[model samples]
Target: MTVPVSPRHDETFVLNLGPQHPATHGVLRVKLTMDGEYIVKAEPVLGYIHRMHEKLAEASTFAQFMPNTARMDYLHALAFNHGWALVVEKAAGIEVPERAEYIRVITVELNRIASHLLWWAAFLLDLGGFTPLLYAFDDREKIIDLLERITGSRLTYCYMRFGGVYNDIDDEFIKGTRDFIKRLRGRMPRLYHDLVTHNIILIKRIKDIGIISAEQCRRYGATGPVARGSGIDYDVRKHEPYSVYPEFDFDVPVFNEGDSMARYMVRMHEMEQSMRIIEQALDKLPEGPVMAKVPKVLKPGAGYYYSAVETARGSLGHRLVCNGDKNPYKLKLRSPTFSNLSLYGEVAEGMLLADALALMGSLDLVIPEIDR
Candidate 1:
């Protein structure tokens, strides 16, 4: 005799995971449709910290707009400032002095290192490792000190002008950067690489998890380490070549693994490459005008211009639709974190909670940038 089986229903739960949780990073909420620990579907709900930066830019003058860029990515404010300034300079066809260009390159690269160090620290913290955060902060403080001396600000810096930098670098500033670079170089192997990269727990946690292929990355417009980890050679600095980057020699690190660990390795190697760029730039540092001559009150002709620069996270683009007026007609920013976050829904499907957090961390989503 055989027993007849009855059609049965399995209960499911709708989980509101974050928006207040420590793992969410900011005021980020994830609505998850789940069956036990595995996520059947995931939706990232944004707008928690919306500031309407694009619309606000339209009401401000070209020169007045530089400060707003810093508010988007508080971690890499200079990159945003540089991105907007470069676009405006290109649009207006203003020539930046050679010295100004080198200073821009050096400062941006140093900010990149600072940004990556913070990421490294936060990433390790996400994995339940705390020591790397302290070590990373120790290195980052030196960069902050050097930048503050020249820029007169630290976190949300407004140092880049439309045609050049606000101030020139002094001997003390140069010496600070050079010494900090040497210190970071010496500590890289012992503190960063050995401490986290060699940690068996970290390796096991990230490796072979949250795999994203090259095709998916391109489809989603993913840039930076997330895209390069998928074997795509798409660094804006190399491919587009802006702001004296053409004069510098550096390699864009690529990894074919397309996993979280690959993303980690790519960023780690990128830190080293940033150091190389800085050293080269310092060696060839020259004496010249640091600011380009431009009228006190500026206005560009009516037209839309788009420009991009590689930030610590990835490619940052600015779209300005100018009306030839003092104020912009319209403005938009293509933040890398926005595009990188777009891939989250597809990548997080069917993943466990731990794996999803790893994937989210791998994308390096900056909430302000996303909401801007």
Candidate 2:
């Protein structure tokens, strides 16, 4: 598509990045007003994907919405699954067994690592380093196979239930997880840092670029690594403990620099923290029933309840209004990417078009979540 020069403002023109572009990752369109490759303003255009999730929840039973959770953010689907379960469980006052909580934490942390690994791969590819992309995927595939063994889906998982997970992890899953943890712990430095992070070009490309201040994060309600990268010490798993997360000891990686490199470093360190959580949970794995004894058809009492989980991208909130019915009265999802992407317009204004794309990549957006 040709972007004709504006005769009145000869140096400026409006350009559409994509409703279908590889850099946009999903069906995300951005209308940008640019002056000679420098973006004058950036406006994200959403709604390419229909949400209907809240309406669907109102029509379907509590248990039936399990699959819908995964479709929103397929990269971190299990976290969505956990958030949905937490929503119904909190509203219904369901008691999950200690063993099941541990299982959920373990699975969710593995998924988090997998999500970060994929981001690392894709982000590197965006930066024009294709070799690290292969290495990143090689590491991510191990965790993916491990998750598929128990969750039964490699991408969009429907493994979580109202009270606990739908299935119990066997010895094979345990062994696979342990082996994966060890392998990733060993290869992370050489494959990720030495190959990509420390490269001079990579450093020039990301470091001190697209700076986001802590004030900007607060203004935009950005969470996860984006906030953490800007020196905001808020993580849902820590700030509002849930599941078996409080039991685990891990550090929240923060970088005060607030640049694209800072965000990249935060995720890189987070993968280590996730593996640490996974190892600790494995060592303390309890032996009991994974599935809780809940009604076949779950009908939460009349009330309003919300649940928040720390996904790969950040805080994922699921709010529900129940009216003593099998289906919810209303459901609202607070997606982190939506809030994080909101700041893109302000941040991208003065940056070069390439750096703007880099900043977008650093946000690790799952567009369907924003569209929803």
Candidate 3:
């Protein structure tokens, strides 16, 4: 919802945020019934970039839909790739090798860092700070370049197959990841101190603004930092124990205050946590082929299968129904941003316009994910 000027009789009027590509992240338009600067009611209008991916899934071969997964959440595209691969593997009873699993974990964690970094940059830009974007990108470039070396493309990657990954990791990838970890680790303090923690303007703007409680998150089915920030420890990685995440030791960050600042801190802490996972993966890097042996033609004898993974945004779930065909008869994608964005109407009701914007930014939404 947007903030408009004062009206006569304290009359409530609808304010359109966007169906255009301004600061609302994507073409998200929030129709706000405003009673002179305060939102009386909030309703989000969606479907600006709806691609009907589920219908496309019915037409394409199971493997052909790999690229489509990334389109929904480009920031965490690898997680989408991994999620799709996971469901198909489960459906067909394909076993990923131990080495492939390690490679997948490492690459996914790096992608997670890149996603969080971009969100950090964009969220700061929404707060009117431009410099953070540069620093964030400087570090993020290393991850993109590293992934591109193996995945062949940078942003919307389709590097995962049903049983394993597209390519194996060489020493180049291993060393590059190690160097990047060192580089980014040294820069984390500045990110926290200079731009966030001690900045009075940011603190005053976000500290107690747009509070979302634990009850609110549970009610809304909010996950990821949006849920964790509100003291709900429901990370798919930890709670569900997907991939090699159970082997890694990292604490989920939670804040009881549940304000925009709490969300901000959660992501900042998560970046560090992601680094921990990547470091452990690199050290335990094994030797083997990345891709597993599978039938040239895939025909799963499946009724229904579901798989979930922790994307940078939250829990990304893929459900498929196969009638012993090469293509899925039914497909469902559960995007985290959609659920997180749904909470906006309730949380943003009485917040100041600027504060509401900050809270929305804190959610770190990628609109294509919501629209799809």
Off by over 4 Å in 1: 1-10
Off by over 4 Å in 3: 1-10
Better lDDT candidate (1, 2)? 2
TM-score of each: 0.96, 0.97, 0.96
Question: Which candidate gets the maximum lDDT versus the true structure?
Answer: 2
**Candidate 3 global CA lDDT score:** 0.87
Angstrom error at residue 7, model 2: 14
Quantify all predictions' global Cα lDDT against the true fold. 0.87, 0.89, 0.87
Evaluate candidate 1 by giving its C-alpha RMSD to the native, one decimal: 4.1
Of candidate 2, the 10-residue stretch with the lowest lDDT total is 1-10
TM-score of 2: 0.97
Per-residue CA lDDT of candidate 3, range 1-372, in tens?
234434454577788888774569889999988776787677989999999999999999889999999999999999999999889888888998878888888999899999998998888888888888898999999999999999999999999998789899888999999999998988888775675667998898789888898898888889999888888888888887876788888888887779888988888888888888888888877788777899977898969998999998889988899999999999999999999999999988876767788888999899999988
lDDT of 2 by residue, 211-281 (tens): 99999999999999999999999999999999989898999999999999999999999999999999999
lDDT minimum window of 10 residues, candidate 1: 1-10
